[model samples]
Target: MGRTDELFFEMIETYQRHAQTARNAKYQETHEMAEILLNMDITAMWCLTQRTPDTRSRLI
Candidate 1:
């Protein structure tokens, strides 16, 4: 898998592990984030938000 994919999965795993011991409110937020990541169309989302270097410079 690509580096980005590996990092994304690792982030999800971290959140899942945190959810196991996180307090109620923090647990809920982490759990939700993990679920969203699990279900999201990550590549499509990245494509939709990806900016060219020119556009990136304009936002600064």
Candidate 2:
């Protein structure tokens, strides 16, 4: 894959890790994040950092 594809997959992996962490911690938002990562397509996942309020704030 190209660099953009690599980065995109990396982002997905990072988000999946975070979701697992949140689920382990029993945070209320865990389900929401996990759902987004699990159910959304690549385009939607790419926009996730901007679409999710909490994630946007934390990431940016």
Candidate 3:
């Protein structure tokens, strides 16, 4: 993989690890909510990129 891809995956892993660590903490309610939302948003964007466009994708 390219360096950029490796870096990207590393960042994702870091976020996931942080999420897990926060989940184990006592005062993590707000942090958990924010982390979950951030994860969801990033996942949604990645899924969107994987979709094959039915129209005018490459031309645009």
Cα lDDT of model 1 by residue, 1-60, tens digit:
545555546655665654544434455677676556544544433442353444334335
* Candidate 1 Cα errors over 4 Å, as ranges: 23-60
Clashes of each: 0, 0, 0
The superposed Cα distance between candidate 2 and the true structure at residue 13, in angstroms, equals 0.6
Task: Answer with 1 or 2, whichever has the higher TM-score.
Answer: 2
Report the lDDT tens digits of candidate 2 across residue range 1-60. 545455557877866776676577566677676657655545556585555565556545
**Model 3 root mean square deviation, Cα atoms:** 7.1
Q: Which pairs clash in the backbone of model 2?
A: none
Q: Give the TM-score of candidate 1.
A: 0.38
Better of 2 and 3 by lDDT: 2
- Model 2 ranges with Cα > 4 A deviation: 26-60
- The lDDT for every candidate, in the order shown, is 0.50, 0.62, 0.58
Candidate 1 clashes between residue pairs 3 or more apart in a chain or in different chains: none
RMSD of each: 10.1, 10.7, 7.1
Using lDDT as the measure, the top candidate is 2
Model 2 weakest 10-residue run by lDDT = 37-46
Model 2 per-residue lDDT at 53? 62
